[model samples]
Target chain A: MITAAVPERENYLNNAYGIKSWLLTRDHKRIGLLYLFTVTLFFFLGGAFATMIRIELLTPQGNFVSSETYNKLFTMHGVAMIFFFLIPAIPATLGNFFLPMMIGARDLAFPRINLLSWYLLVIGGLFSLFAMLAGGVDTGWTFYTPYSTTYSNSWVIATALGIFISGFSSILTGLNFIVTVHRMRAPGMTWMRMPLFVWSHYATALIQVLGTPVVAVTIILLFCERVFHIGIFDPTLGGDPVLFQHMFWFYSHPAVYIMILPAMGIVSELVSVFSRKPVFGYQFVAYASMAIAVLGFLVWGHHLFVSTQSVYAALVFSFLSYFVAIPSAIKVFNWTATLYKGSISFATPMLYAFGFIGLFTIGGLTGLFVAALGFDVHVTDTYFVVAHFHYIMVGGTIMAYLGGLHYWWPKITGRMYPEGWAKLSALIIFLGFNLTFFPQFILGYLGMPRRYHVYPDEFQVLHVLSTAGASVLAVGYLMPMIYFIWSLRYGKVASANPWGATGLEWQTPSPPPVHNFDVTPIVTHDAYDYSTVIGQEVEVG
Target chain B: MSEHIDSVKTYALVFAALIAATVGTTAVAFVDLGPFSVVVALLIAVCKMLLVALFFMHVRHSTRLTRLVVLGGLLWLLILIALTMGDILTRNWVGVPGR
Candidate 1:
């Protein structure tokens, strides 16, 4: 009934025709679609590399590929996945599309710069892809030096340059978001009136602007060391290798927050909407994001506990690492509290949110295990570390990415994806993900190190089980790809507010017009104010 | 946003002070103040940075948020250097008995 009553008008999708329109368009929504296509391609490319690694690990004998090829496989996997896919996953796509809409703006402050960022990412990705195709860098994604600089050689400079270029893309996007958030909110859309998603992105942008430059500088230093034979990270040339660890993790640590904060923002929206309640302690959740961004910088040393870092420094880092978890926990607790006695839905997005909260908790707790200096001595470089991050990156970020994608699909595409398939895939991903990574925690605790092509026969059973789970996870991922494409033509037409969501984004058309709002909306209610629409069916216009 | 336009006199005065500071840095480098040489050099650099930020960059005339952004960048840099120095400084506090 709601769909029938809604008028169909020319929207972003039908506003133009052909390749030139999309390629040269300055529309934020079109740019978001561009990012969605690019990142999804990289996701599969990264996923292909992951499949190779998993299959190779299916047996302890390392029968599938040579050790060197295996090294390249995992290296490319990490490089493609982290730099290309996960880091830019939500912000470049979802945030770019919706941040302006949610705050009642026509577009981001710098639309051209937004387009440039996507182009930069494409160029950067091409460079990395060229490196992979040429010979593949085998420095593990960290590109730890002396080895990266002096010895173990394979396209290090090319790959680092690729990442360096991509880093600019990230920095530019962050600048755009920061300027837009500061200047573009509609009248009455005060700081407190903004959605938690915007709040989290604002914090993420801070980290992006401040922190990405450090990694870019680090890569530059690495470039100089490798190409110019500088004595920066090479121990034989009087360089302290540990200093590389220091500089690398300095950015890489906050880089973890870069990967997860936007995901947390998505979860904040999902939990509140599905629970039909305003997010509990909204200020705490918002400030918690800022706190995570700030505190995230102080804990980089935790990555160096086993590198013979000083006991005092390690102690300081360990303590601060624990403190960083407090803000994250504050978020988790607030989401849970928001669900108390509230009308909850089992929609696909909310299912993914539940998956994120559970898996991210496990990931965050295991981080404490690795944060301890003594404990890190045992688990550093082991599958425990591998599992811990996958839980966070895959379980936490990917789950939330998928959740946000499903939550906003109606708005982005004006079609409802087959909900039954979405829910089933979410379930498969959760089960298969747990099956794949949970055993790694045990294998790691039992002293199985990572990145090995061969292992003792005793580790074979767990490896088999993990590989089986990876197969299932592969199916889980593929189903969405197939159905999301299929849904474009055949799925149910979506009303503007299919989910009864409460954001300025929902006030417009399903696939909004060229200018998002016909007239700028002045916010009159708090975010996630579902009570007003609870009993009545949501209207499209 | 600042209605106050900086006069040429103010610019010239700051420029003269910077030149003086550069000369002072060169003079200070000639005399070894033992371990404090690096300290004095860094202090002079900080003062020069303040001059540039406050006058040249017009941070002095900027809004509170702009000032906070500048300070925030500086504080983060301090955290990186100080925390890292904590590790480098005390690395061999207990040396292994033999090489």
Candidate 2:
């Protein structure tokens, strides 16, 4: 009997042990895991605030918590979710893990700086956590001026400082990615040969490096105004409150692309892999990411349409806002076309990708509605705007984040999670997410405002539905957490390429070795090359 | 990959010009050039920025990509300020009810 030899399973996981190795290691994979644990904690922390907010809104009355407490809860939720969790979610964790691997590099250009970025995030997270424990901030994540500058006594400075510190983490990570992509690609991994994930990240890093500083400056100015009684953002002084919005949105608007573009990159990979085809219009999809990033910067004025921003500026912004959607639409169309005449699988990741396409379409279309000057005047601060963003952020980004996580879980951990449970959870999340946020669109159309502790009684039914959906959404999010943890011990060991995908990462062993590859991989084919993958699958099986 | 190193003489000359520009800025601040003061001051500032970017930042001798990166940052900043000024400059136009 001929026996197949089993290779030794020494990898990043078994290469080191104990806390110090993890805490001080410059290995991007370990650093990615560090980020994973940190951001996961913050995700739940943010979710808790969201749960409280939803429960309180279950009725028209502010019974669950005081109005002041409610404000802090939402603010904390936004700050934790955006700054600590969403902003760093995919990029810090998956990007940190796979970028160097995918690009066939040993590590990011600046591995120590990558580690420092995580520390900065932790330090930043601690400041926000302290602010929360010390009574919390009422200024919403936007930290809009006048209220943030003059009124509302809360831990605004500490929270702002937390955000300020975290901004550097983003900047450092961006700089590392920029340099790595520029300098560290494998010998033959030319610009067009690189995966869409790298392209999207390159775009995201651009926004991160170029756009994040303005927000940091804005926050510093806000801190100055709040602390030293400066009038930079205060209307009572010589400064203009609108100026704060200008600077704030200058960064914040592009920040939305930062959150979604990576998700788009993930979807591009998942769609191609599960469909067993090269991405349709691959170059088009790649350039679309760059187009979205560049165009994203031009449309910040759309957010200021109702904020005493000039009609002329609003027109330009609204027009540009509509323009940005073209690239997004191009991506959506390309993904759908990739599915044409392809052997498609309804795997968990593909299901989430499908969910992303439908939900992101709704979210993107609603964004267009809000971009219109006439429609925006009515729904600017209403639940419509809230729903629109949730549809994009939660529906779009989180869906893709979870999808990417599930798709890469086998590779990341060298084990297969129970597939049935994963699929069920994906379904639950999709249904629950829609049930939760869809009603808010209707409520917003009915003139129901957001950030209010007490709403009119007419909106009670929608509030109850939303709260119920929140509970379901909570379960959906929790199920994967439990199963993913459980899989670590009981699941079957994953093979090198569980999905039969085509990428440098899949070419390496599951839970790849410390340096990722035993021999450096030289790419000879474009990304998503399924021709050889399909033929190889038959012989292997 | 190797960069061109600027000579000390060139550096000294650029430094001296920056100083002269700074003094010109201060002197112009004292005078009332009205609207042109801002224009003149911005022009001088732009010149100083160009000098630093081209020489100090090494864009003059760096790869085209590096030059593009610097240009990209400037272009984005211009977009932000210019579009914002469009709003601020035209808020009272047509006399909307809220205004």
Candidate 3:
């Protein structure tokens, strides 16, 4: 086993004085928890909007809501979930928290920029809330032209402005992570020795830095279209709406990988830890994250299959789309291989890891259908697309987020969440998630379209089933909110290494010191070296 | 360290070449290259971007991990642009009655 060069405890915990201290702190751990709290609040709010959409879909008519109101509900749901919750949930919170710690650093390279990212998130969220109160936007999250630029009257600018602001937060967070991982590793922590989670975040950060700027420009052009009537996307003004889509998806397509890669990163850690093995093909898994991120940008046009894009372009995109699947499949196979003949444990995190595997597979497979030229044309804007994304975003990303939250809760809070409730919530989330999204896949196949306030009579049964599943999904989401808060005061005090996980964070005290390590640690081993912890008698042998 | 020096020089030369190519492409755009015009401009643009990414972004100087990240972004962009264009361009190719 390799040795850890332990540093002295210099009271990094009590070094601070006020609320302002934490609010303005550059500590990665504190910033991460801060992000966790804020993103969770938005997750619930986003879910509430989703719950409303599903409830309305339970019937054929636009019951319990007007068409305009239904439009706003679904639009806000997409905006909130995509921009406010899922996009930032994993990378900004869990990745931010553990990346530095895992790399044995004091903080991200540019700590002030990190703090700015959180503030930007809060400001963006407030703008969206203001939009909701003033009325609400109904143009859908894609904000496709004609509708977003000329139609739909409910405070589109305020909501789009919020999304625009959130883009910077994403960009800044990406920049900081990239610089830190490059410049801040502890001595002896070579790139190969780093955890797969850190490598995945590094890949994700690259996309955020490069791709988000293009979207920021797109949103600006959108604002120009709405306010000034400049007609960048207005076909009447010698402008092509398709160009807007190209610009929009240019950023957005990569944005999908941005959302999923970090979750894949988190899954890597959970799978390795639970399976009691170093990740199978560590270099390959690490490279695949980057591969997915890079390839992610090329495949944005798949969203425009039935739009004004060319058939040649569609064929090429379909083929390239298939290429991206290869790297993603590589990761799945490697994870399964990692679980081969190991002393596996069924901890809360492990259950979510399994959940991620199953849901993400369904999500990925459906994406293949969407990527195909013939199939996509048949169901371009249908419920199939909706179900396809929700499976990946909600089913895959959110599951991994919660798993990471539960896995790292002890480190963040210095307390244990009730284990029984944690496991039950994971199960509920899995069942409710499948119930909520799976039926929509069939509905799409049967020709039910998305973003409609009303549907045909034939689609009602599946819609009702989907809505019923959403309620269970809500319960699944709510349990963690209840227990995690309850655990803060009443739960048992946890030691530094509650799970016997072999990361640098476990070497620090519970809840960690303000600046993270009192003095920097020197890493001399590869991550997930379970033998080191086992030799110390940390786990139940 | 030797790898770093060689890549840095390579990056610098490519960046200079990119600037020159951009100017040349814009000049050529004014000429009637027809469909080839857009293709040529894009090709030059792609080359310029590659240069910036490889040298300025330090992808070439960095480890294989970094290179993989750069490649990942490019590969995805290719899929997006290519597939979308495929559907749009092929729309009117056949005597499929609707057209």
Candidate 4:
């Protein structure tokens, strides 16, 4: 490890002491840290709800809780994970921390709005908590109609309003990233020369700005239904419930891309860094990110195959869904190619990267199965669908998140976590994750539906296995929480380029100063340009 | 920044036209145009949205990449709505045997 180049240690502990300063801080790094703390808190809350759900499913009866309570449990879990955690987890924390630094800027273009987004998250989060305390809505994350507006006993309006507010937070964040990427890059940091992480985020932000408003309107219409009895989604009043699904998934489906695109970007970086090579097929990988984001919008109807949609429509969506996979396959293959004939290291980030590839491929392929109308009819709400999404959202997104956290810990904290433990946790997470999710796929195919409090006796074996693996998964997740915090105080001082990485963030001091760079260094070479850095184009002031 | 940019006045006029079109569609909703009403409303909404997106969002003046990004969202939205309707419209003619 290289020694940190900070002129003098700025006591990170005393740097911003009061809650007010932290709340009011304009520093992008501080904002990122704030999100890190909040999102982590919500992660466990969501995880606890998930644990409750898995435990309830351990038996074939509604013994652990009533059906209503179980419904609330899963609904809250889905909302908390999607809205509060996954969507913002990586981009908000790591993206906020590093995007400005990587592009050689001091801060995001709109710092006050950056701070505002976090506050919006907290406020929206509180609204959700209040809604839960007031007897939570039992409508699933999709909030399918008739069930949501006409049937559910809980406060649908409050929860829908909370989500509507949070959608603005996402939109604002996307707008800021777009402006920053457009106007804030240092001289010579060309479009291709920027890190793949930024490129992926750029694509994600494009979707967020364009797609999020549609959902906001949809949710507001739902809220109006609850309050004013607006019959847009009310079938008896000549409104169509399927239209709501259309609008919701129109945003929520691409929202999945918003969730995974950044993770793909992270994997691209980690694979190249660990393998010590320029990413193979850089242009294809780059354009494929945009392709996925664009194609992601067209295929939302695939989710509606079993509903009132026509067979011809389902066939079209199935074809589009399969086509979307082509770009995803291209990305996966390029990553594999980048690893070919290269110096591959089993670093912690690289370990997580490999886990992402394996898990995401499984998740994506199964998505194909569900997207096909015939297969979806057999297992629409079954454990298979659950397993399919969990592989992508949890196994794929969360793994890349941990990988990015480890990759950038040195830069953020100026300290390195213990390598052995990091790798151990990565391995445990990989194993525990598969154990928890894989059985659900089989159980689903065996005709076990999800969201039911209990299942048949034969499925109990798998359910118990899933619960046991969840215990292990919890352990794997908690390990990093313990060690990463410990490392901040006592770990070795990290050098400017501990991983010998080539991003501009690495060229600066570890625990970068208030202003990221003392002088902006013009990036005259391609990203991951170890060869150019060593052989030809030098960093210029 | 440039004096030749008196076209700002023209762009403003275009913006007013969008507002008028939007209000016009909403107002004509009361006039019982039958199925044609929905089509007319949506067509006008599309025009206004496009004008704002292209001119006000600066897609027209922006680089090819930005135009591509803007076009991508629109084109796919059309595909989704169109293909969905394609299936719904054809369903009556095909008439599945079970029903």
Chain B TM, per prediction: 0.91, 0.92, 0.75, 0.78
- Collision pairs in model 4: A2-A495
lDDT of 1 by residue, A185-285 (tens): 99989999899999999999999999888889889999888888889888888888889899889889998999999999999999988888999999999
lDDT string for model 4 (A88-191, tens) is: 89888998998888888889989999989888888888888789889987898889987787778887777787788888888888888989999999999989
lDDT by residue for model 2 over A381-438, one digit each (tens)?
Answer: 8999999999999999999999999988888999888889999999999999999999
Record all residue pairs in model 2 with backbone atoms less than 3 Å apart, i.e. clashing. Answer: none
Fnat of every candidate, listed in order: 0.76, 0.80, 0.64, 0.64
* Lowest summed lDDT window (length 10), candidate 2 chain A: A532-541
DockQ of each: 0.70, 0.74, 0.33, 0.49
* Candidate 3 Cα RMSD after full superposition onto the native fold (Å): 5.9
Model 2, runs deviating above 4 Å: A1-8, A535-541, B16-37, B96-99
lDDT pick, better of 1 and 3: 1
Q: TM-score of model 4 relative to the true fold?
A: 0.92
Please give the C-alpha DockQ score of model 2. Answer: 0.74
Interface RMSD of each: 0.8, 1.0, 4.0, 2.2
By DockQ, rank the candidates, best first: 2, 1, 4, 3
* Model 1 regions more than 4 Å off: A1-8, A535-541, B2-52, B97-99
Residues A117-224, candidate 3: write the lDDT tens digits.
Answer: 999999999999899878888888888887788776778889988988989999999989988998899998899988998988999998898888778888899899
